[model samples]
Target: MNHLSRRAFLQGSALAVSAGAVSRIAAASLPEAVTQTQAGTQPPLTPASGRPYQPVVTLNGWTLPWRMNKGVKEFHLVAEPVLREIAPGMKANLWGYNGQSPGPTIEVVEGDRVRIFVTNKLPEHTSVHWHGQRLPNGMDGVTGLTQPGIKPGKTFVYEFTARRAGTFMYHPHADEMVQMAMGMMGFWITHPKDPSFMRVDRDFVFLLNAYDIEPGAATPRVNEMTDFNLWTWNSRAFPGIDPLVVRQHDRVRIRIGNLTMTNHPIHLHGHEFVVTGTDGGWTPPAGRWPEVSADIAVGQMRAIEFDASEPGDWALHCHKSHHTMNAMGHEVPTMIGVDQSSELKKISQLIPDYMVMGDKGGSMGEMEMPLPDNTLPMMGGQGPYGSLEMGGMFSVVKVRAGLARNDYRDPGWYRAPAGSVAYEWQGAAAYLPSAGGSRPAAPAASPSSKETVVNVVKPAAHKH
Candidate 1:
């Protein structure tokens, strides 16, 4: 037979044999399996009596469910193509796990043994590296170093005990440059042994990822390393991002994992927090310090905790201004201090829409320039004051008093107290005493009432 015919015959034979074996096994284990399934439907394992910290992490997304095999949890993660929406109008074709980019968060309790089966559905070979995980040397998942790569259409199993409890992540170790750039990553969280040790009322988790896709393009350029334009949190841009909601005085923990090329200094307005844990493990009380912003480096994870004392809609975003924008053009020239008004007037004769911009300073944020379809403007958003002028990797933390402990709904915008808002001065002007010790009269209104009048006299013209 030819090569194609022989390959097809072999695949068919294998499938037939696998199906027969499954049928036999199912018939033999039917009774035992039913019992086990019934038992598995019971409540999940919980901490011993008096433990304060229960696992309350709101994946902020979703979690991967597992099968209970004996005493071990079995999870299946399939790496395949996915069409994910970064925001309302922007979507990209990416490679991720189990049909979603930054695949479902895997939450397990400490001391539990887990088995993860990763199926490679991509055209190329792939392997998953458990970032910051401690496992047998042979199960490290590094291609050629610890284990062989999982060839396309093949699956590999990784078994390990959850030794530490902290924030962690996973991504491909083989062709990492291409796979990670294509958005193959996921969050792995292990709950502490003593649940109440670091208990918090609310917990949020997300991954920081970047992509280099040209405006209007659907796929990311996997080769570009430093010039990424699409910055995202959980592969989502701002406005599309769900705000973090909490009740006043609630203890909150936010875990951030960075899988991008560069580091990000995540900043939070109107609050202070401390780095409580990392991928390595939890930080001791003595080792912790307060911070308004924390720098998370590539392949690193940081967990920050704070008390939601101040109630309002607070901005939480990357401190890097460019990181908070989408499809930003880094190569654009600076037009500040350049006189383009006269040229623009002439150009408008030919193109009626032509207008001069940035002559005094950069005004891209204020201008409603046209952008490609399915692309977000470099800076955009409306705020109570005016334009928020921000995009990617930005979100708000809505804290309100009297919200139920378990309520995670956004409470809408906060209303500021009266007389606190800044406004333009328009009512009247005050007068001061002159050098003769008498108050100067206020400026009189113009006779026409259509224009205002100035009381000061003009200086004499100089003859140079």
Candidate 2:
């Protein structure tokens, strides 16, 4: 059966009995269970400092001709952008692959001879870095390290066998930070012989992304965290987009990857995912393993499978809170109408309170608007600003278990696309005092004039 249909069935079963309890657990962080393996002597993989694994894939973009009669099962990728989120209600020109951020997820089986032809569409030089697959040096997509970066308007072919069955990722190793932040990462999964053990009722993948935007501008900017503007799942934010969907009671597999310079500790609500595979290969013998959550590093991939025994709109997101906002919040002291610099510090001692707001009882009311409760940020190595001080990046994954498409209910106003970061923008809109006064009459002019007279515009929180 198709994964989606099976997912619906399981979700429905889960919802009938434990909806309330599951809902309660959706947002709470459960403690991880630490145990020794059968040998009882080897150390377990600690969450703090697990050894880093690498995966790699080839990338080239080219049009397939009818003359190319044979079907190409193995594939490579190039991360580029055709559309981008610049600001609330604005899309911009940015770099990404396959017309979106977080290039497409690639799934394969072990021992398959994967052949990938990469065609370069960008005007500049770039290459694809497989995060954790151990291939021969020639198959590595390093620009200068393994091979020269693919030039614009060219194609490179990579051939390799799937020796590993696990979760891995791909991205550009050249200009590591900037290119990745611009949306060049995606999830990769491989299944080995006897794939039945890896089978599941549902499968989902996500590529997490963060954007830095300038206030009042339509497009997000480059990698200066101070000006970072928005966070997203896959590509878009919430409320302005759609949510990831799943059916009840389905055995689901979610392949997650982080492509940016920073690491992401992804958490799923209401359930824990089994870390069945890593970047290099499958666990000694792939089967269910106990792990409530997993930390996915930059350019790294992790394949996690879980049973959807509980049904509800579950949240999946990163743990860093600051990574969820648009660029405006990143500026130090983050405010206007106040001069906190040395030039104005003497004349504006009182203004610092309004500008920073950090001095007042540990709060910045607007920036602290509550994220959807069930969702949390993945605070693995650093917070949003690369240190514990700023918090970390985060997002939400909504799991609608057991409900068939026809049986599903609208999950309120905002929903995000599968595998992307999401944000809340309610505080960004202007507000008028609720003075218990009568509604003001429309001005004797165009609607624009009435809006100008009242200074009230509709509120819309942009989500990807």
Candidate 3:
């Protein structure tokens, strides 16, 4: 027989053996009409509904279709290979669910019975583990323990009731070391039954993933555990990640899941937020406290809520410097105090392109060193103040006062109010002390003095 026929025959034989007598008895007991209805009728699946909650648009977005079967929501997730872009110039071959790395977000309502069907299209066995969810032991998706793994070309089903509403995730429990490193993961969000409980105007969700793909390479080195180079918010690095836009004064909730080897201290500028919930569910009012940053460890999730009261473009990124860089050399020696100038003078005579780096300090990020094809600089980008010198795991949150509640478009940069922007000092007022302390004698008012005085000063610019 041909390859296709032989494979089909083998699969059928395996299923018959696997099913044994229980399958025959169950099939025989079902009435013909009931069986026909079950086979022909399919319910339509609707997106999780919570009025006034704005859906977050995933960068390079994709999502699975769901259907209601006998009041239970059914979702099909296929595990297969995919090509994913990390940034503008870099793309990698990865294994994920439904054609995207860090597979699509699965959103459902709490207390709903859901059935998820996972088909293994991978080359080897695989299983899905619902991380941080309370489910039956048999449906835990642990290969060879809770249940046998789904072999290649086979399918497995996991049915459970989403008892608690929180931010969670899913990944392969079988061969996780290799599977997860290859980018096989996705986000899971269970909204509360009561829409008003812990409600927000905008709900954003994303997974933090890391990879160690070498420069110019198209696939991640699955063997590397800790020394990952590319840090991503959703398998996409900075400059490629879409900004989180919200209307001024709107309540916002951002749910972040971390699957990388190291922890990420996610920081948001210009605002302090409360840790409203976690993988375990909403934090008690007493446990909630204001914070500017939240640390999410590997295999953990954090949900933070804040009011978009300020109108500006604020930064949201990991506080770890290296985590903000892409493809950085971890072993590069620190030359901050070392002077390679004298030696470089002779080297430059033979090679005109040779140049010294990190001599005085703060020059590493400023150097225009050549990088490999399909690779990003360790630190790069342009900002209002000049070179942003940032990469990986970084994005902006744009808030505007007149933005429509439903509009999620970027509003460009913020415009400063008159006399509010920092600029080079033109010899403004020099010093000031508390009203209780001694003060300088009042000087005669000049034409400029009539204008409002700004106490800001510009420090001397440093040389690289």
Candidate 4:
């Protein structure tokens, strides 16, 4: 039944009845709820049965597949407790829809009528709020205000027409704080009616989410507020987060939604872009300004467009330094520039695992310290040169030329032209004279002239 086409599945429904109101159908005839188990960035799900439009790539996530029935696009989401791998070695017990945390992205057209059936499997009540949508009041999904909470084992239906062409999000409005902390959220994109409107060669979408899972623990602290631990993009930390692959000179648009408690100043390297859209709607041509970064605040969505003009593995990450680090390192005491050799030896006698950290700018990315089970080093990711020393909310935008139009595969590392890469200087450390000519040494003035001049120059040190 899961693999059946929309027509076939609807025809084979167990309790098929007259289609007076599709939303009122018996549970036995509900649309199949497709779920995903693999924790990877799935290929964009192209429209198999609806108005044709460009689909978006969800970073480390996938879009929900819907069935078209009677001109309505239908989707089923199952809410339940699930295990979500935050990265390669760490898994968290979270509650999400259709299998993963920060659930599968939902994509729709601007004027499409959408019918979503939600089946609750969690112990508590839940309701999906279509954030930043223009919809009927009764379908708003706020518990006790618009609709009652969907109790465990109960299925609820929400039908609405997507009236806006913009970016949006969906999350629980019932027990909002706790459920969101448990990762019950997802991305939504209502593409414009015209496929060419604001079209780009590549479009990528993801959400900023965080958790308060303690080291060696698998469940988030639902009550924690500002003291969160795992800062993630689409529930994945750096290294575990896949790169945004684009063909060179492609028109690229990245839609980002912030569901975390705080804001994230997302920065991109090697290229500049402009804000093409936001939660409210697409920006007019006059309103857009070129920028390399955008600060997305809580409950906000932003779509930035850029041309992948350069070919390289350019960095794209959050500007907040701590937001780019993993859990344990956040609370560690500052030990930079401190000599702890003798102290570490004394402490090692009592605690055999004692080790010096951050002295002489030590990086946890290169440390071999044994960590508690199910945790990540604060700053750890491998790059072509050496340790990236980065974690959380970071990834590379690999722009390469000659790639297939639709290809999103990692192009591996970029190969720079001869002498293009920065290298250790083999020449003198002192500044050299300008190529035109060494200016005559500043003329010396006699004491009686009341002024004397001397030239001083400083060499610059470049770091990547």
Top model number, TM-score: 4
| Model with the higher lDDT, candidate 1 or 2 | 1
- Give the least accurate 10-residue stretch of model 2, judged by summed lDDT: 60-69
Give a tens-digit lDDT track for model 2, residues 1-464.
Answer: 01111234233222111111111123122111111111001111111111121212111111111001132242324444456532223465557655445554455556655555565677678888666787889778888878998888766667677686777677777776667666666656565556465576555556666665443444456656533445655555432223344566666666666655467677788787787666665555546567766887755667687877665446565666556433334335634444445645654454332223443333332232222222221111121212222222333334564466332223332233333334333342223356444333322311111010111122235444
**What ranges in model 1 sit over 4 Å off?**
1-60, 345-355, 425-464
TM-score per prediction, in order, is 0.79, 0.57, 0.79, 0.87
Best by lDDT: 4
Could you give candidate 3's per-residue lDDT for residues 66-142 as a string of tens digits? 54545665666878987887776568899988767877667777888877777788999999999999999999989
Error of 1 at 50 (Å): 18
Model 2's alpha-carbon lDDT is 0.47
Q: Rate the local accuracy (lDDT) of all candidates.
A: 0.72, 0.47, 0.72, 0.82
How large an RMSD does model 2 have?
18.0
lDDT of model 2 at position 127: 82
Which is superior by lDDT, 3 or 4? 4
Off by over 4 Å in 4: 1-28, 329-331, 429-464
**Tens digits of lDDT, candidate 1, 301-405:** 999999999987799999998898878788878888888878988997765545576678754556655455677666665554545678889988888999986
Pairs clashing within candidate 3? 45-66
Regions of candidate 2 where Cα sits further than 4 Å from its true position: 1-81, 86-88, 218-220, 223-227, 240-242, 284-292, 331-464
After TM-score superposition, what is the CA distance of residue 200 in candidate 3 from its true location, in Å? 0.3
